[model samples]
Target: MSVDKTFYVTTPIYYVNDKPHIGHAYTTLACDVLARFKRLDGYDVKFLTGTDEHGQKVEKSAEGFGTSPQELADRNSANFRELAARLDCSNDDFIRTTEPRHIRSVQALWARLVAAGDIYVGHYEGWYSVRDEAFYGEDELVPGPNGTKHAPSGAPVEWVKEPSYFFRLSAWQDRLLAWYEANPDCIGPQSRRNEVISFVKGGLQDLSVSRTSFKWGIPVPGDDAHVMYVWLDALTNYITAIGYPDITGEFARYWPADLHMVGKDIVRFHAVYWPAFLMAAGLEPPRRVFAHGWWTNEGQKISKSVGNVIDPVALIERYGLDQVRYFLLREVPFGNDGDFSHRAMVQRMNSELANDYGNLAQRVLSMIGKNCAGQVPQHGEPGADDREMLDAAHGLLPKVRDAIDRQLFHEALEAMWGVIRAANGYVDRQAPWALKKTDPARMGTVLWVLAETVRNLALLTQAFMPAASGRLLDQLGIGPDARTLHHCGSHHALKPGTPLPAPAGVFPRFVEEEGAA
Candidate 1:
């Protein structure tokens, strides 16, 4: 496909100390959907995801396992890479912070910050959370059980004293506020933007940019003893993956990423610290950062201690791959917390996918096979119902594009499903099967409209469920080369008498085992 525009989207590089869970999959899948949509719409898209391997937590976890940090990172980073493939993510690149390219990029960024006078050596004494890899002020700590103090994220904090390098975060406070006010849509979901603004407004403190105590991070540019702080190193992965420091080639094309998809917990880092670092280095900040919420398993918080962490692989095994993919984005609003229940998953599959969309395709195509000699039926003439249904199918592109531009995945899916639901209603009212017996010519016209509608639905769904939608389009005689957003609507309607494959169910009804969780 020829492309004139470019889009770059990224998932927060998953921390290698942690296992790949549904949360990781959720973020990456959202990026994948957007990337695929843009590519189909004729944009040159770059979708990136990978692992963050350096930090005190990884060091501690490596010691606990009696292994070197690099060994642990290699093993775990491989798992995240596999998860992307397992989920069929169309990410163009997978980056690891430990890679030589990333090291060079991070060091280059550090040097640029130093040259800009944004970095200064200083003494640091404060509360630190190894779990969160962050420094929290005394005012931000909350009392936990047993009189222990924790960061706002509930990670335990401890007093630490060391010589460190600090980023001039306070110096950029006014500039950050001005930028936020000028670009209101840069930080997504409105609520997240407001929260970030409040934090910056309350106060700004110079951030400790290097940790003398941790040996598992990128060392500061001119000092070898103090390693760069994890967040600064981690956020650099965005520009690094796109080829920064060189300032040309991929960097020139795709820098200032179109979107950064991260969890709500790290909104402060991406929305605040990341941009400050880039702008300090005389670079453009990313276009947007969307912080999505977490997920609970069956009404309980997903915790490893509770043994309730949802595994993306297990989900795909239990349900089909496309079914699992569809449910994750559809189950909740993109920026709100959602619960995962077996009953709800089954309901969506059996009702929406199987009954509403699957049945619509199966019955229409099956009738054509039985009555129209297994070929695309030609439309007879214009009719009110036919015109209305076709118009709705054609109208979906703009609604979906608008929602997706705002990172509204659930809203975009709803817009496509609106057309699907309407097509089902049209099928019932037209009753092509009865027309096959009463009026053959009218039956052909109704079947033609339904087939065209299915073609549009399949094209829209390709971004969400590629394999299943590809199969559906195959049944409609829509070849792989013909499957793009440009091919949707009445303008690209199915050719008459085109040979079509036999209809088969794409989304099967998911059945639960009696003893299943």
Candidate 2:
């Protein structure tokens, strides 16, 4: 809660076997919004995202593409970088496993785990899902097509037997359980925590950490015959970005990251394996791991075969970027699955944004422009309705902050919209145009109250909707330094008689083609 503390948050490094999709954009956008909120909240924030380019799956994909693994990684990783830019992501660093710095850190972490006696040579014979890049016990497999076994996740598995180095995951099960007990908040969204707890309760087996079957990974230290498991190399990217192992600068400032935002499919890696690995290496685990669910398109699972895989770039092209950004977090509660539909998107755009928030800015700022000689108006004597709306606006910061802190993005947006709704109602009741003739002072007060409220709303919502909010702030005569929470909350006055630009609607109604939904 203190501004002096650092907030380090990360999205899971996306696997670079293919191009970016709605799922990847969704997670990175969430992290971006949180990072922006923290910076506006006065925290020193370090946000990270990147591609996980090392793995057997990537190698196979490269072969299919008629390219070497590094060539494939180079091409696909650039796509992710381009996607981040297109999405307006504010990630502080973008790391790839192929980077020398990352390779060094991964190897350092491996040596640390090895030195701690938590890793040993072993033979692994199990059901391996190349798609999932995970090994499963026979009992955990379900029937698949062609009489083959699949992971519970339905990813087809192949029986794999190989020489591998194993991490003593079973040895740390009790320690992990005890750690979870001591720090119950470490894994979030009670349902996710319960799922993790239940999984650990079923017991853990020693995990194979090095793969000899594939050479498209970080080579194990002192062993050229094997490569470190992809997850180990990938997860260590967090520390690598922060200058870990050496432990200076960013590492010293933001080690033991405040949050690891991952998808539900990979929760076990962060909640179980990651923490155990950290503790075994004599390091502290991350402060929290919050796993969010997947997204669906039009009530069906999103897949390439379905011809409905939502391309983030195409979605942004179809809808405005901030509009897409706003709907993603606002339509769904942060830790739950959500569906994307054109109908839903249009509704959110036209109603919540265009009508509720954008309309308020347009109507009140327009009134100020016409009535107050095109400048911010001064307040009149305090009145009940004015104070009520002012109270609602003033109360917004803490409420939004509380929701954002809990990662309840829907709650935050809803709370901001509550104040916005009240401001709109105040406009209807006072009818500022009528006041121009008789109660001019009261009208000025109303317009002033509305402008200040709109200013706060713009600044507050900027994290969620940057481009649109920037336009809103520009119309209100606000600039960069004036947009922080401290500035918004200080009861500051916009410069009276400061000439303002004509306001324009930021969110326009989305019109869908026939049968689009």
Give the best candidate by TM-score.
Answer: 1
Against the true structure, whose lDDT is highest?
A: 1
Model 2 agreement with the true structure over 216-327: per-residue lDDT tens digits: 9999999999999888888899999999789888888898999999999999999999999889988899999998889998999988787888899988998899999999
Off by over 4 Å in 1: 1-3
Residue 88 accuracy (lDDT) in model 2: 95
TM-score of predicted structure 1: 0.99
Q: List the RMSD of every prediction in angstroms.
A: 0.9, 1.5
